[model samples]
Target: DAVDQARNFQEMLKFDGAVLTKLDTDAKGGAGLSIAHATGQPIVLCGVGQEYDDLMQFDPDWLLEQLFE
Candidate 1:
């Protein structure tokens, strides 16, 4: 569902990149990976928490660690 939604939005809007938010809430990282793959776009940023300062650059290794941990 999320993948399709992301793909559709990306196609319609033609966005250059994507920001994956609420990773702190979904620690598994499924949505992030799926959306990135479906949209064929890089995840340039990730939101770790609610605070503005929680935003961080997307790191595939870090995300994989979170997913497997």
Candidate 2:
């Protein structure tokens, strides 16, 4: 696998939002957060469980709505 590719992609990016899969299985979401931030990316998505597609996409404006809601 291209481990370097992930790193390279991380390095070249400025600050793209990201999503991490398998968060339940993942330990404290540390690795995913680390990798995303390490690549200069902000995590904007997360998985809630072990389903095939149990993802939660964080919208930037969602925060605004929540605050107003």
Candidate 3:
């Protein structure tokens, strides 16, 4: 196994505060939820659009609601 070479995603997790770019979409927001939960981190922001100002902060519950709705 490449366990020794495996890099921890903690830095990415801490830096992101939950808003993962790869999962930035209306659907499948669950992916972000899972990552945050698994890493025991909180989601404070999300960039769901293609603009600097589009990047916005969100509560975990609100993100979940968006996905659910």
Highest lDDT model number: 1
Pairs with backbone N, CA or C atoms under 3 Å apart (clashes), candidate 2? none
Model 1 Cα lDDT, one tens digit per residue, 12-50: 998877898899999988888888778888899999999
**Each model's C-alpha lDDT?**
0.88, 0.62, 0.58
Q: Identify the runs in model 1 with alpha carbons over 4 angstroms from their true place.
A: none
RMSD of 2: 6.9
What TM-score would you give candidate 1 relative to the actual structure?
0.89
Alpha-carbon TM-score of each model against the true structure? 0.89, 0.55, 0.61
Better of 1 and 2 by TM-score: 1
Please give the TM-score that candidate 2 achieves against the real structure. Answer: 0.55
Residue-pair clash count for candidate 1: 0
| lDDT string, candidate 3, 1-69, tens digits | 111111246644344455555336545576666666666667677777787877777656666677677
Pairs of colliding residues, candidate 1: none
Compute the lDDT for candidate 2: 0.62
Task: Provide the global lDDT of candidate 3 against the true structure.
Answer: 0.58
In candidate 3, stretches whose alpha carbon ends up further than 4 angstroms from where it belongs are 1-7, 11-16, 22-26
